[model samples]
Target chain A: MTESTNTPVIVLRGLKKHFGVGDAEQYALDGVDLTINKGEFVTIMGPSGSGKTTLLNVLGLLDTSIEGDYQLEGRAVNTLSKRQLARIRSRQIGFVFQSFNLINRLTVIENVALPLTYKGGLSHIKRLKKASEMLATFHLNEREYFLPYQLSGGQTQRVAIARALVNNPSIILADEPTGNLDSRASHIIMEELSDLHQRGNTIIMVTHNPDLTTYASRVITMLDGKIASDTDSLLGQPSVEFKRPLAMVVRPSTDNQAANSQTKPVVTTLSKVDRRKLKVAVRKRQQIAKNRAPARHAEEYHQ
Target chain B: MSRFLLSSHLQNARHSLRSNRSRTLLTILGIAIGVASITTIMSLGDGASQVVAQQISNLGGNLAIVRPGPSRTNFLTDITVPQGQNYATSTLTDSDVAAISALPHVKEIAPISVINSTITGQHSAPAGTPIVSTTPALSSVDGLQLDVGQFLDSNISQNTAVVGSNLARIIFGTTDALGQTAYIRGYNFTIIGVLKPLNQPINYNNIDFDNAIIIGQDIGRQLSNGSAQIQQINIRSDSAANLTSVVSSINKTLSAQHFGDKDFTVLANSDISQPTSELFYAVVGVTTSIAAISLFVGGIGIMNIMLVSVAERTREIGIRKAIGAHTTDIVWQFLIESLALSLSGGFLGYIAGYGLAFMISTALPFYPSFNWQIAAVSFGLSVLIGTIFGLYPAVRAARKDPIEALRYYS
Candidate 1:
């Protein structure tokens, strides 16, 4: 069970996930090969229905009915039982979703630390303490007892990310984690992810925003369930702008106030014509903020 | 999946039930009512049986009765024997009583004769009272305790009788009924004593002793065509330990007296109160089973609420699955939720059942005693029903695909 971090953490070769059978069969992930090494922040970009989610699901061990050779940490995962896969997923892979996916009935800390329940042998009190520390990392220590519904979109996403990393998973799989946040909140969340990346955590993110690739060490664009363009876009990375150290995000701050009451739906869920209008508005803002690199990055990443 | 974490699961289950207060309360009420009815019914059966057994034991530990046929008396059936061939027939005779009395380990015996004729003295009971005629030994053999006067002695005169406390008050209008005149079967007799209340009316033979008129055997035989049929003979052994041997010897003596016609029954060797107990068990069983239907309905309520809860929390299930929760985990969550509901209902039902039992014991003649078995059964039934009914819905919740659940709308 001891796996070194230097090994190729995930290797997906000829991964094909079909939705139906016979004439109705449609490939969700059609013959895609991708190998992600340790400490690599890989961002996946594609239009909707381009197999981005299916690929993420396959890698995360949430979907197994796919023909593929998925080797994780030098071990072949295809033959592993569901229980074993679940253990591996719990110990090594964490997931962050566009919807936050926090259980509405549980408090913020319970939602954050629920994945630890499957770990077994961990005292619940100690688990809560660990969850408290994880929440502190996102400057959310004060709101640990709040319910998911009581939280703002940004706070909910932070709680979700805290849950994902509570087990200390080496790889975090995020499916448009910032998709639900407002422009300001999205910047703060992305900044936290960037901090995590600097601390040598491997992250695989699926997003519709092509400009978010600037945060990734490698970017793979998909088309019709295939990797149409694989680019190692390291030069345009946001490393130069993140002058503050990663440890600073976890520092106790007295002024970290709650998010405002005003809330907006995740941009992707908006109607097509409204989304188009928003995108056009974002592009105009980007052009005006071209002189400012950080502002331009935020506009591109969100749009 | 690794560790059960029972406490945590219970806590979470309780939390979810609390979220829907009204539905949970209704479900609890359903199971509680069922439990209460079952407890009441069970108490009735237990109480009735205990009362009969205690009554039998009170007749003296070594005592046994030989009665005709399988006709044991219960309050639910006829309590006064009719005057006809059924009562006039000598299924047993005075010779049988003498023969049993002469057996090894045998003690003195008393044969009982019942006459459903009215006995009034200065006042009446408004209904015909039963008069029992037996020898002097009848008092000790049947464990009768007199309040004021001695029982019938060896007087050849048929002019003396004993009245029970209630009848004494109703007839002679006083507990000092000794030496008072009473009319029985158109014959005037002087009351020699007033009997204490027996506390119970039902006995082996169909006679309410508390309201009955007791007289010496010879006088009663003369009144009923110079000889009356002996309905039952009460036998008391020298030692309780030798009761079986005594009963066997009595049977042998009786069989020989009847030329080997074994038409009589010995109480210690047979189900003394079988028919009555069986009737009671049948009635209680049927009624309580109907009450159990309420528990079944309560379980269905839990399942209905759980199904709604699962559907409402589809996204929660998906999130949990994505975070490495096994199907077993999901199943346990829902199952525990359902269990919590039923068990709470059961607890409420237990309280309510005791309440109903109290009301019933007061309203009815049967004195109910506490029974742990009934509590155990009703509580266990609630939990069992919860598990059985909750399984399908819990399995359905577990079967949801993470992707599909994630996309589910409100």
Candidate 2:
């Protein structure tokens, strides 16, 4: 499916986070402005002390206290109470940490189902089914019964991603998700992320490896707790392409009157290949019309 | 989020306690020792008090003993009765006895005249055998029923003497010391009767009737240089219920007789009952304090270990807070853990205390009486101490900054 041209899912303006007071004060985040669009695969790049994790924490609503406005899906997060922030974090944003942060006592499936359990909108059986489905997608079906310690680093991270995806959050914030993985495992993880992005899921990952930027649609570089550069890929197009099928296929009917109302005459003769091509073009046009319907309705309401 | 916090708190508490089993056991032991000490002391105290009351009751519930003060003597010390200094004094003579008998609630007034005399029988017994000279009223007032033969009569003129059962058994090989002539201080006296055995030796005037040779009061006085003086007055109340009133009246009368100087000391069963009770209470108090100290120490140990646990699980605490654990939740977690440790220790200590008390009571002369109130009070104090001492640490744990705690590696 092709990505929808939706508004930015995350918006941060003049964000700042400082620690300590007076002369001892140090900036963990300094006047940062950033926007992450829906269905975009974005990667944040920075050094160890460059506030990459701190930015992720702020974006994930794990840390607050900044001199800025953070709007997640048009809701101002900075002014929200702790409970509201928690609700937003649980429902709208998912986080994947460097250390995999799996409760060691919980099994793999239980760890994956953590977010769903916290959100608590589904029955126990349904949650289990969803969790199993998600784990199967990650090829962790057999490992669902194993503890975190029993799984390899890659398996644990896959479990972590499954957990992040369980709540169907609007945005996934990953801080050094590949920091502890080897090259092979890192590629496997990046492939999973690429597939998620291809499916129109928004992901924001922070990494120090510059080569991993090819997987992202946008790359944001941070220096000294501030954004230094932001760039979008020119040629690394998304893998999935949306195309709807034509609804014009006709079948002969025995009842002439019924057929007359349900079917239309073929006015021109064409080859089978040409007919299929014309149908594809018509379906594409119809999909565009369908996509623009909501915008048109909103515009009419504004008038 | 609240569920996560609760589960995490419980998990961490269990983990910390399991990780340091030695410390937990030691703390429990300290508390147990404290409880055991207090319980044992209390049990012994109760036992001793009961023993005293039982012994006193056995002697005579309504018997009141009247003794002279520093200046005057009673019937046993009356020198004019011929018994000399061995007798109390003429200050408590026959007239005083007659006057005491006339008082209200007075059942019988018996004046005892005692002397130190040596007697030779089949074997020579120990010196200082009490040779008591008294009237027939002595038998009734002291509740000393004759074992064999009859008690001495005031009208008897034959220089006859009655021997205590123990004395008779020792000197004559049988309580049938009747018709046996015994030499007392070079005087020949026929043992015409045998007195009954009284389990407890008389302690009022340091007299032991087990070795005593009893005779008629007038004859005894006449034989001992005519200087007989009453050493003690044994007054029996008409009824057991009137003991207190009789003792008070007798005290007032004696006090008046001594020119309002209050020289004579009057003793009832209750007066002898106070010491054992006081000793018991004092022991209970002392033991309870000791137990309290142990509980305090155990509570402090719990706090110490809890503080360490908080420090160890700083990151866990931060994670819990980040997930939505309120300060109150954290406080409750730590407090619950402390209370659990102390309360369990209290229960174990109580069982141990009871066991120790039982063992000691069986091995020693004291009989232990368990008090549920003491256990309840101890348990309450343990919980209180746990809470009081655990508060600061729990609050400190709860108040830790989530950011800083999250950053803490260790």
Candidate 3:
């Protein structure tokens, strides 16, 4: 609930799910604890029957019989009604499935704009424009009029990603997004996810391939309905390294100005430049932030 | 849940129907046939009744026909004369006719003796011409007007006869048959008169006047070796106002003469027409029932196909439910689809039914005219059948589990 930079985007405490009752009961998810923070690309890796799907379903609000506390953006999700759950799912969660789940009868753009169509407060022209923009972002502008069956696996996944981004969701929950693609297609999809994560969008993907974890900032390994290992930096350190020279220079100036008077002019000039730059940066940041905020928050979980 | 999703469902249904065009057409054909049969039978039955009623009303109001039985029970069994009793036993006699004439409010009583006798003349009469023997009062009771010559006299001093216009045509080939001799069973009788042409053949007793040769009652009995008996007594009331009183007095007199056995019956116009009306209604009832069965079968076919459709679209149902569709909306969608099919079919069937009824009326001699009331009823019944049968399938579709349904493929 505190306004902390490390506040978890998703948190689950002591989650337990049983499929049946008494002797016939099957434990799908048992006593699981996990937390994912903002801007972190987390991949859940497990073999079949490890309850990866069950855990994903519980997080998505698609299934609600588990005994646990689920907090999304610091709000309890367990007590929400089905209608409220649907609203949360549509407004806050984006989903990319292994099978691409795009309605075959709808054109690519229509499939992407499906959530917006159901929400129905926007003008048709505006929704279409937004859908086109999302498609254009994924280099799928040419395939907008094509149905799901007309697109290649890679192209379909791109469209699915565009659909996820169309509603401007907060987090993307992908279940084996690259499972159905060839190696070349799989790499292209992972590259897109990595780029999206670097853009400050949080992603929680479930995959059986360990090689796919190279793209994630953190990897949570599951075994026998439990977390076996929470591996951070499975591929490398989190790709949050500052690339701009001004941001790098400003970081050293903060410490140097406090230490010596001889460096005052340099500090002052840099500070003035930093101030002007900060204003420009702040304005630029605000614009980019406004542009990207919706996509970041729109993703919840998809089954 | 959402208008977009609902529209999507309709789109899906349309697509499915189009994809399986032959199957869809077959189903529609099945329902159409059911609708058409029900509509045709009910409409035709109603039309027939109306036509019969109309024909009955065309006959004169004053005409009263008495048959051999007291009441029309089983006409073949109760009225057919036995071999031994045929000569001596008389149900209606000449004395009874005189008594009916003497009653108050009675205008005339014409005693008629009918026999299936062959006739011969200069020109041959048509085969199966009835030989009728009656008094001069027969013309007044029957409301008959002479076409050319006078009716028979009170006394049968000579062998003179009065013939129906059609019979006169056959015997003499022209209305100038006055004083022509017409032979009846080898006995020569002069045709002194010819009656006017009555377009309708006699219906009650199955007698045809177009081929009849009429003579004096005394002369007829003499020709039959004194075994000729009066089959019916034709009575005429003085006025429409005196009908009820005249019928009552005749019943009382006939009952007294028959030793309080009530072997003879006296009927007014309305009473005589009751059985015919009831017969018409019975036919309508039977045909309507048959039509109802076809409608029921059609409704069942709709329900069966709808159930299959719901199963096929299980995934779609789940998706809608997950998106927040209520149970009632799902039910309404399926129910509306069924009602649309049935009502459209009913409208077409109603038009077809009336067309068939019209054709029947023109093609068949005794077929009835079309009735709109029956058409309306058939239409309503088709809709009711749709609603009743569509309910369970709609409910089944509505109550499906979202999770399980979502998992279904194909």
Candidate 4:
């Protein structure tokens, strides 16, 4: 397909998701505005209760009933029915969970063909054939008949990736794709994801590891249910300095000059002790903010 | 509901069901027992009626049997009254037999007078060995065969008798005792014939001919003090086509002779096949209702197992939903599993039922029959039960929220 470089794939404005009622209410996602373009790999990092996973769920259309104006591919998704959203999820978006959710009873090929089984009109033979071809791309042809437990952690995640892409969805959503893997396995998964990015597939990944963000075209960091900083840097850098920003202003970007100008130079001199102290201080401030909203923090516990 | 998706769902269901082999087998066993009883009961009931029907056809379609009282008797009366004791209050007499014999199309008529008495012939026999007195036409009307000598002659109404094969053996010590003298009610009678052996004891005739003696009608009346009660009469028309006319005329003649009391029943064709009156339907109906209750219990067992299966597979449902399975897909997966369970049970029950039926039939007079209709009904009922019981659990699995489901650990 022919592609425009700056076409907006996802746009969210004033998106708010809250839990509980009245005095016990808490906003998991509070007034978040963001835009993701086609073929751009974005990585999100935040503290435990910062609504990063919730935002990913909303973007994947797995969660609904939120206050928002969200358009996917220029079509308003907030007005779509649950069934229509499911259709969009199956046909246009793919999700990769941290646990590598392959059905334990199914063989590797059958697990990879799980998504195609839900789509109408394809026979089981054809679905398996497609799954076999997808597995061949990952060099997993010999393990087609092996169950999930029989595969190593890296092979299992690769099978999950093959399953997610079996239908050739428009965007891939990975919620800590390497969460359960060791460094070497995580490196291999990151390289496969980068290869997918080089092939023009849009990827939105959630991770706690800072080193993996070097593969992203842009980086977004959230704090206290809101975007604390959004930057277009660290595409291929080895080390970087953290930006301490209090909710940066979000705007529509047609190659915005201000964001490019705010790109801080790489800092390779920061010690591990200094980074640890910065993380500890950030956590202490977050705890104080959570303490100030006593009712909301209590509700978060209930959730 | 696409064909491709249906096949895929079927494969998935098969895989899951096989994984839990013990549970599936136990659940299937419940349905099997229920279906087995139903099949066995149906086969036995149909087999008994088939035997009686075969006997009726063998006697030729031109025959009609007349007995005392109305043809339609209730279940209570049939069970309380022992076979021939119901004939005590019978209104039939020798005149009714004479009146029926005068009909236009009637070829031959034989009135049976059961004289209850003991006999002394070289060696004494049982006390209540019935001495049936009838005309020589009885041999033709009842399709009886003689092993030796001749049947009672109608022209010579003397003290001549024909003994059954078993009665001959009991009183005279041998079936070859053709010239044996038997004393009945203080009158001496010479045995002229020995009947051929008949294996059919449970027949419409209600008489075990193997232990009975046959004498002339005049002797039967003399023994009963000239007030002999005619218990039953068997009439045969010249041709099968003349049966309806002969039966109607006999009914009219008997009604007119008894001053239109209508106390006699003339039965032919379909009515001849009714064994032990209408008790056939009553027994079948009661037992079939019991079988239905068992099937209902079996259905409940299936529902319980399916609910447990759904609970155990909650995380599996979540994983499938996360991978893009719709609500209908999950529902069909479980539904198909239950269907597979019950349908296989039905098939096993069909084979087991026939085996049981054949085993029991060795003691019975008739063999149980096998047909496609019974197989079809067994399978149809199995499908219905599976659908009814599997639906709720399947729907529960389908309605689980994908987000909550994916987070489930078990």
* Candidate of highest TM-score: 1
How much of the true A–B contact set does each candidate keep?
0.53, 0.05, 0.05, 0.49
Q: What's the C-alpha lDDT at position B377 in model 4?
A: 78
Cα lDDT, all candidates: 0.75, 0.69, 0.68, 0.79
Model 3 earns a TM-score of: 0.56
CA RMSD (A), model 4: 10.9
lDDT of 1 by residue, A1-303 (tens): 111144578888988999988999999888998878787777787777888998999889888888978888888887899888878877888999999888888999988878888776677787788999998777787788999888788778878888999999989999999898886667556656766776778889998764455566666777668876555332333332311111100111235323322332111223566456545644643454344353234333222
If the candidates were sorted by their lDDT against the true structure, best first, what order would they fall in? 4, 1, 2, 3
Residues A1-303, candidate 2, lDDT per residue (tens digit)?
Answer: 336355778899999999899999999899888877788887887666778888988887777777888988888887788767766766777777777777665678866765665565565567678989998777778788898898788878888888888878878888788899886567567766766877878889998765466566676767668775565322233323421211121223447747566544322233567556656644544454455442233221111
Candidate 4 chain B minimal-lDDT segment of 10 residues? B78-87
Which pairs of residues clash in candidate 1, taking residues 3 or more apart in a chain or in different chains? B32-B349, B36-B353
Model 2 per-residue lDDT tens digits across residues B88-149: 35456566567678889988877887776687778765676778888788777766778778
The sequence of per-residue lDDT tens digits that candidate 1 reaches over residues B108-138 is 6889987667777998764757788888898
Q: Which stretches in model 1 have alpha-carbon errors above 4 Å?
A: A1-6, A232-303, B1-4, B44-60, B63-138, B147-163, B167-194, B202-208, B213-235, B243-290, B364-367
DockQ, structure candidate 2: 0.08
Interface RMSD of 1: 1.5
lDDT of 3 by residue, B1-410 (tens): 45654664455456555555665555555456666766666555544444434434454566565545557555333223221123345587766777777888887777777766777777777765778888788776666678887888876555889888887777788767888888877778988788777653523323455568888888888877786677667777777777777877888888887778766666666544422323334544555555666677777877887788788778766655543455666686777666656775677777776676667657544453455666677667667876898789889998887667767888
lDDT of 4 at B213: 92
For candidate 3, the lDDT comes to 0.68
Q: Which stretches of candidate 3 lie over 4 Å from their true place?
A: A1-11, A35-41, A71-78, A83-94, A103-147, A161-171, A191-202, A231-303, B1-6, B45-287, B318-355, B364-403
Docking class of predicted structure 4 = acceptable
**Taking the tens digit of each residue's C-alpha lDDT, what string does model 4 give over A87-163?**
78778888888999888989999998988888666888899999999998777888899999998888899889999
